[model samples]
Target: MSRNVREAVWSPDREQIRNMKMYRLMEKNGIADYDEFFQRSVGDAAWFWEEVTKDLGLEWFRPYRQVLDRSDGAPWPKWFVEGKINAAHNCLDRFVKDPRARNRLAVIWEGDDGEVRKRTYRELWTEVNAFARGLKQLGVGRGDRIAIYLPMVVENVVAMLAAARIGAIFTPCFSGYGAEAVATRLKDCKAKVLVTADGFLRRGKTIPMKEEADKAADLSPCVEKVVVVRRLNRKDCPLNEERDIDWDVLMSNRKALSAEATDADTPFMIIYTSGTTGRPKGTVHIHSGFPVKAAFDAGYSMDVGVGDTLFWMTDMGWMMGPWMVFGSLMNGATMVLFEGTPDYPEPDRVWMIVDTHGVTHLGVSPTAIRALMKFGDRWLEGHDLDTLRVFGSTGEPWNPEPWSWLFEKVGKKKVPIWNYSGGTEISGGILSSNLMKPIVPCSFNGPMPGMDADVVDEEGHPVRGEVGELVVRQPWVGMTRGFWEDPGRYENTYWSRWPNLWVHGDWVQVDDEGYWFITGRSDDTLKIAGKRLGPAEVESILVDHPSVVEAATIGVPDPDKGEAAVCFTVLKPGVAGDENLKRELVTSVAEKMGKALKPKEIHFVSDLPKTRNGKILRRAIKAAYTGKDAGDLSSLENPGAVEAVQQSSAN
Candidate 1:
């Protein structure tokens, strides 16, 4: 298993090659070549999506008059044209109809304090219904909006499904957000109601949220009601008799509410993903859009079928949170929701969850893998993680060292790491690793089915073996309708680069074998002299050094060269980064990526600033280093990290 998974360890077992939905669909369509099948899928995306839903056995109240209606435009391609559907019905009601589905577990949640909660499909259905009735009682009807700010608890899922059940647009706010961050989203969406918790445990400490919610509600005049879930059973939790209500009081009756048959284009949730500056852009996903895409990616890429357990280390605010829930349940599979940091109480917490519950599919990030690798493989020694048939990765581009470590140590080189790269706007994945394929380290086999993704030069011409912008030439079912209340901005952001293609802002390369590797965000590309390379390319080489735990490379303005690459690295706990070690890190990058692409300066820092979801904030890092404004840093988990980088740069 320790052998390199890039080449030697790609002998997939017979079970791995079995007919899944995509394979069967291709075979049925008389498409023999996988590549040609993808081309045909792009050629007739509408037919392909209709076929996909049919294969998934999805039901709709009113069948679509047209498979797709691009009458509006490509940027706003309407899917399931003139169709009627409800996301919650497909996820909950359909599953609850079958006794086998209802009896199976839907979600298994674990808190940092050893508190565990499990809900079967039947139980989840009842709870969602009860919550829906509660919302109805509170006058939350169709077209109304609600905001949810809670920890990774079962109630969060219930609230989301309830909102979707009643056709109310809901946004899952990151529980760690400050009052301003929460209020901005609430104000933008004009959320009428907010579902939150008193507080949740983190690192054995209670992080209060009631006060923050109270402050945010005050700031957002549109919010009329605030429902507080009494987590930890805090009797003295903050309460506003005029506006705030208890969770139990709201969900008192085990009443049932009928799922609203919403128009296929009805926006179900508004997920706010912060940009480099300005207010966070709320990516509006619809009833049939995000869910279908998520389920398709999970089912096709990881083979997450009924009875399998899927766990993605993510937050409710992040795309993967909703992705895992809708994807797994729609596939009739169970989802694992664990709250708290993966290494807080124990380094083996992630493995423990997989072992305790039979997690057939496990999704993680490269940052998490790098951090875990620092603790050595001893923590993973005694755990039996045989249930992990497939590994999933997202969030950021992977460095080869951590990628190899994950394949070797956790997977034992037996399972494929299903690397997926996409965003909240896309709902699922643009480029994803498939079950029936060979995997090169830190690379994707190709674009996911139904996606006509390609690497294009600045002029929109396809480039081979050279880094370029990742673009989608054809429309897909899961593409975001548009940014909330800013269709013009959405058009400018995605479609303006090319006539109709979606410029995804990612820098990618396609090898001769057609394996795609996402280098980093295109905006994060470093132009050192004449060579254009991504920061991840330089950072990956830096992280390969023994002392470097993780690295963030940024392109700083230079005197001779227009811009030069500079690295800010955090060393392993036991390792020190002296001048000699810094020189070694620089030399390693030079040796790996050629001397022309070498960094102008290499600074060792105590920490690298990152979002709560573990993405390195290069913009924040460059801002702090350059003494420039770091705009809209509410998404940042640690302010101290930025200051540490600034101090290191000064030194």
Candidate 2:
């Protein structure tokens, strides 16, 4: 075993006091061993989930008479049957009721202009109550959808909690999304109100979010009002009085209002996931068990506890946004919200925030780490990162180079690297690394405490030591109720493949030691001359080359090979992207996987098309290379990336 792996096995971090409840409860039950836990959790799912819900402290108005109501088939299984409790209540009310939590910091906002703002539990309650009153004034009621298109400022967090506080369903669009993308989500949810900002600062430049809001409003006729927060101090931003209201004025005279609890199964948010083949799907999450599960996972798996300042580089539009908000705050941990680009002013801006806030747990994407890796280790060598205990990564598969760099430099090789995997539908991580387990590079220790996850072959049989589809055998508290107004689509998308199991659309594998490795999306799996290959495996091999900075792989049609692997790569500085370099990359892949999986073509490019949340858009790359219309260019961080790839391919 490697030195890091040996150390992780010999000595794992002990769980803090506030984080040990779930493990203790699990031990109280028959899940004393990890192997036995995995077996029983998947084989006897109903009993596993029933015990989980209670151990996690999920609130329900009426107790679920049964753990699951699968009479309607797995596609439409009813979890927490006939239960009623508001998610906002579980996140906010419970925290406020704890006398020790009243004075603890709930959120800490750090602006790009070097301004810092802190809000305690008492203060956050007032802000949420006032914003909830404002939402009520805009005629938002139970089950109504409220679209939030704001920066990662304090107002954005307040808007989501406020909407949920009053039983309204909140849907957040990433501030980086363009008008059409925002319009599609708002129209799909039939949003009644939009909370936006006049503009926001990014890399010291003013971005006009209100303009996009106006264009989205023009497209979405269901939008009744737009609440605008003053972020950039814009004087002449366009505004419609009949439909647009100043956010500050809306909360000026509003008094603190009590939360109105709703049914446990009532929709809390409509999070849209960019589907591989179609437009984004609005996955609807509910009130009852999501908060408890998020909090429990953050505490137990990530080791976040009271007084710890946590910061995950994410926006409200992504799952990590809601995950950070409920997870950290519910455990009485202060959350650090950053409102600008991570590399603003300098490449070390994120490191500065960590040092400034004494942030204990830092969550970010692998893309961010890759970008920083290009700058060398000196950028973080002199910084004081002693406050950090754990580092979290998500969004995409991480390369061992960047993953190890994060551990050695930022963590001093002591802190645990908590690699988590799941989608917006699962609310938080279904498979995550726990504090008590050894964390290998780019691998999960195991499934979360209650999740019944497995790597299954095409025949629905368990597979060990080989890549297969990742599926959940049982339902958990945080699973999405269904896609909004698209029950048929949801059924066909998730449930049709594996009979009662929820196929999570990821290609995963389990080693003999039982550690899980995710190999990109299952839909992105390519059959090169009838042999299955995962894009992540090829990409990981490419990234291992010292000359390569980043890489993305996709399958393009080939008359001879049926479907051939095509790789696009961005080289490190001073590394020539010539014919010899291309041949070297192909040779590397051939040696790593096999000659059968060798790429037919290797195209050098400046960048890859990725979402604002840092997920590479593999479908866009496939469509671009195949001459198919690249659908929905709205979620891309660099729309020009596709054009660049096309130009390079032609050359």
- By lDDT, who's the top model here? 1
Estimate, for each residue in 241-314, the C-alpha lDDT of model 2 and write its tens digit. 89999998778755767666576677888989877556889998877556766776787678677879889998
TM-score for all models, in order of appearance: 0.98, 0.95
Give the alpha carbon lDDT tens digit for every residue of 58-127 in model 1. 8899999988888877897888888999999999888788876788999999998878899999999999
Best by TM-score: 1
Which regions of candidate 2 are displaced past 4 Å? 1-21, 27-32, 37-67
Residue pairs with clashing backbones, model 1: none
- Per-candidate count of clashing residue pairs (backbone under 3 Å): 0, 3
Residue 152 displacement in candidate 1 (angstroms)? 0.1
**Candidate 2 CA-lDDT value:** 0.82
